[model samples]
Target: MAYGVENALAVCCFMTPEYQESKNCQKELLYADEQNVPIIPCRIRSDWKPSSWLVPELPTKQFAHLAISNKSKSGVLRKTFLIGNTHKELTRKTAHGNTSEWTFFVRPPSSDRDSIETYIKRIRVYLHKTFSPPLVILDRSPFEITRTGWGEFEIRVIIEFQDEWHHEDLEIFWNLTLRDNESYEEVDVEFDSYL
Candidate 1:
């Protein structure tokens, strides 16, 4: 919960128990939760050392959003990409209880025909190991691969652009939380698009 607050957008690195130990962080988490600010979780290698990027600059505007990007060693073009999460209630029930599922999608702000296909394929390969029966790929508009799960769990989302400009895959550690009617607002989908 030691998050970098910018533009009211809270960006926290791959969390560890130690990161959430501080009383100050606990306060920030509670405050952010109360404010209904969006939290973006950025995944980094376990061995990667802390850096300036972990703590972002203070916000100057009342409303702000967080954009987490990973730059190459040279700090040129960003090697990172974005993913989004949406939770909805499933009519079916799970063994645990009422089953609500969260869907993770990679809908880039924009993309060409070729790029969209590449993204779908890439996502399919990325999710192969974890998502049994595989993710269903829609053959129509908004070309993207989506996977749903009953519970909130951390899933590694690996992104590689069509060009493959960057050799290494950028990983996003996403904790997909289940949302129900009482917890969800109409604005949730609208808010997710930006992420």
Candidate 2:
């Protein structure tokens, strides 16, 4: 929802029903979070207030994308999907009884070594969760590219749900690891979640 790099941010705070932190408000929150930029929270209960951080700036030339759809028609809140730089679109739908079937349009940027391992772990998680939805990339299975040297490349990431339970847990427990680029072996692992 933000348009420029000068005043851009992402709200990663938690909100209480007594104080609803709607999606619209988070965009502005993230903007101020950059560079200890001194942002006032929405004054909600349970918001993740940060004491400080080096400002994370959005790219000026290459803009980032955000695909966030908050409640379903029944008002059940779902997941939030964010990629630093990627293009996303909902591709196909099929009506069955009352619910709709789904396919997604995903084309992510080729990640550098800095984020490749992180991305791969996420990809593996999605695949296991959704059992590998009809991937947009037919020839190649979801894989990672390791950078042995100094260079950056973009890649695509796709996540599709098998049933109605999409990736919409307001807070999900997920596992993460840092690995060697070439070996793809886990160097470190941790489990954490956000709400």
Runs in model 2 with CA error above 4 Å?
A: 1-74, 81-147, 166-195
Question: What would the per-residue lDDT of candidate 2 be over residues 1-195, giving only the tens digit for each residue?
Answer: 345434444334333332233554445555554444444333222323322221232222122222223332233322223322212122442232212222221223334223332322234223223223422232233332221112122233443332222232122222221122111111221112121
User: Each prediction's TM-score against the native?
Assistant: 0.36, 0.18
Each prediction's Cα lDDT score? 0.43, 0.29
- The worst-scoring run of ten residues by lDDT in candidate 1 lies at 185-194
RMSDs, each prediction? 19.7, 20.9
Clashing pairs in 1: 7-64
Scored by lDDT, model 2 comes in at 0.29
| Per-residue lDDT of model 1, residues 1-195, tens digit only | 434453555544343334545556556645665566755444332333333333442233132223333332232332123455667777888665647665555653443223444433354323434566544433433534444455566555554434323234445555555653312111101111111
How much does candidate 2 score in TM-score?
A: 0.18
